[model samples]
Target: MERFIEEELAIAKSVDLCAVAEYLGYTIRRVGKYYTIKEMDSIRIYSRSHWFRWSRQYEKGENGGSQIDFMRVFAGMEVKEAVFWLLDFAGYRRIEEPENRIVLKNQVVDKQEEKKTFILPVAAGSNTYLISYLNQERAISKVIIDYFIKKELIYEARGYHNIVFKGNDKAGITRFASMRGVFDKEGRAFKCDVAGNDKRYGFNDVNENSDVLVVFESAIDLMSYMDICADYESNKLALGMLSDAPLETFLTEHPQIVTLRFCLDNDEPGRKAAVELMEKYYQNGYEVEDCPPPVGYKDYNEWLKATKLLQRVPEEKAVMKSAHGMAK
Candidate 1:
């Protein structure tokens, strides 16, 4: 068994907890002076090496500490394993000492790392459940859903019957996919990206000849926008998460795109990202616009539901009036 010295352990503990959380696929967001995880807001990252889970504090009694504790608790790693993983994450390698002792050493390598192969989930025999959920529950139009289904951009996955949204590269190769649950649980639908998803290739509907791009936070919201504006001709992208990696890649691939419209959610994090991205891309010389959902709506889907409901009111009233005239 390899053992680490106190100094080596200290270095491992000093690794940034926020970076570790992000690397583990948890979304971290800044709230006031501390950082909070998006999926589990009860946990707060106090500093580079310190964190605590408020929700577990009373039940578990002092439930967090340095990066070591974070890895052990959240990542389910052993003490020595956590230390080794942290050292590796911080770019340090283990040097074997005499009698099974391990010393941390900074080693540099010039070789490029191999890329992870992206594999999509197995497809369901048919998109029956997917089409019903999106069309009936989400209020997304069948015309729009059928269009994307025909393009091979949307499908139902096997087992869970998740709605899988695929993202393709410039050569039209699927490099990323995100899944949304067909059914809601506890008032929230399950959402997650597929393993080996390349954030640089976000789920998108691109018009190569168009010079404009409209960005959204999720694939459903992108499709919602399509239903709202049937005549829209510009490119559309869903980041899958609140990061600019996909936007950056899209811009690099399509040099013709000059205008950007951000349609992120009407929430704090969404607004903050929109502001930052708008300024950053504007400085890069692209025309940028902040086009969030209308007031009182949380997202484009919510807005679409309201718009659809209002459109049916007049028809409903007409039916009632016709029945009353017949009775008279």
Candidate 2:
């Protein structure tokens, strides 16, 4: 039994000792006590109580010189019986040598080491950066994020982090993707990661108490328009379909919302979605209106920049195509 315990302890250094202990139906700390990290280290006794000593008389070497003499004393088992029990715990078997009289031992080995965990790559310009097809992280700062926040087009969560400008230390930033929207003095949706959803998009504001709803395909466009009409209040509510799915869900849920202002992106997909929505919902007792871009700009962000409706980006810099869903 002592021999088997030593073998198991050796295997545990390479594997998970805690797991092995659990498999053997013993606590990890209790099992670990049998093995010393360094050879020649004396084993530490678990406890020394007068009552326990009086109950059983344990001579150290009686149990084959094992440190578990205390266990034998407590269990009221003879040295041979205790050894048998320990061997049974380790699933070992004893065999007699052939001709003369030698003893042999056998034990089963059934364990495999666990694998390591996977790690993701860092973004561009990072020393450890690698490429990924999906740049969802970049979508946060695209004109859409600001538009959503400014226009109140979506239900901004209370205590949500604010976007930070380069020069301002006061502005708090929660969105890790805001760097993608970094543009020149112009408000154009750049090639950064602009294609994605916001939490508040496609949500209704109950406290506003309005029957008329304003819907937009993307968050930025909705927000740009919100700044354009800050004075208008009441009866009008904003709806941002984070994507095509939410747009469909919104239309299905609010079939009775009569007025839907479609302020989608000026691109082909956006225009197609708007036309499809108009055909489907407008005929079903709904009033649909298209808010086309003012021209020379691909989206509301560009128009807003052109009109100086929001903060000006650098004029010399280029808007990231990846941020604006224009990247391949």
Candidate 3:
């Protein structure tokens, strides 16, 4: 575990709570002098860096504090993880002591460590769980799933039955892999990167002949976009994370690409990232377009699910539903 000094903790706490909420993918709306999260309206943000969960206040007696507390309560991160996340969000990376040297009580100590190798998890005998999770639960089309499976970019891992999304370099060597559990735990699906996975090569479907690139926040979002826009032809890349390392690598590999479409989530973090990236890339001589999901939808996957749900409803019922929503 990493330890932080008092100054480090203070710096982390100094980060804006509203911005931290946005970084965690929550949408905030201004209500008079205070701000409330759209997804969880019970929480109110005020005084710049302070917040209060009014719903919890009745029971917990005013449950709120600095950004660290917000992370602990809302983001469900431990104190250390919350602090580390906040520091990272503020563009701070902690520099630890040299790997070979350690000082304890003014005494010098030395240690040796072995480097770890990158390896994909063992494959499962069948993709029954993977297929069902993607098609039935996620609403991703069978054709799109099959296309990626055929390319060996996706597979069901053994032991845990996780859906592993692999990333390959220009030479077709697997360099990165992110795993997603088929089952939901406490309403959240398990997700993590494989050990030693490289962020420079994110899961992607690059079309050498296309000059346009569509970027998404995750593999699921990328597939959702593909399912929605079946006829469109363009290169697609999943950033895996919000940073642009993968995008930069892809651009370096595919200089023919001139246009970029950022299809990140419509939430605060996604929107802010899209705007920042658009400006950065636009200044770098690339035509950039902000292609966020429609209003009220969080991400492409959610939008796809809503679209599928609407399609299943009877035509008259759909019209009536739209009319009712409009009336509200």
Best by lDDT: 1
Over 246-294, each residue of candidate 3 has an lDDT whose tens digit, in order, gives 9999999889999999999998899999999999999999999999989
lDDT tens string, model 2, 1-328?
4543553322212222222223434432333434321221232222111111211235434322232342364456765565555433322334444557555568454775554332211322221100110112221233444333343322211111112111101122111122112211112222212123232223332213444666654434544565456523422222333344444444454454557676666788878877887777677777778866865667765666556623334432346544566654
- Candidate 3 at residue 95, lDDT? 63
How does model 1 score by TM-score?
A: 0.65
Q: What would the per-residue lDDT of candidate 1 be over residues 30-123, giving only the tens digit for each residue?
A: 9999899999898888854688888888756257787888888888888888888876664444667577666668967679887767788899
Model 2: lDDT of residue 22: 37
lDDT (C-alpha) at residue 293 in model 3:
86
Ranking by lDDT: 1, 3, 2
TM-score each candidate: 0.65, 0.34, 0.63
lDDT of 1: 0.84
> Candidate 1: where is the Cα deviation over 4 Å?
1-116
lDDT of 3 at 205: 88
lDDT of every predicted structure (CA atoms): 0.84, 0.38, 0.83
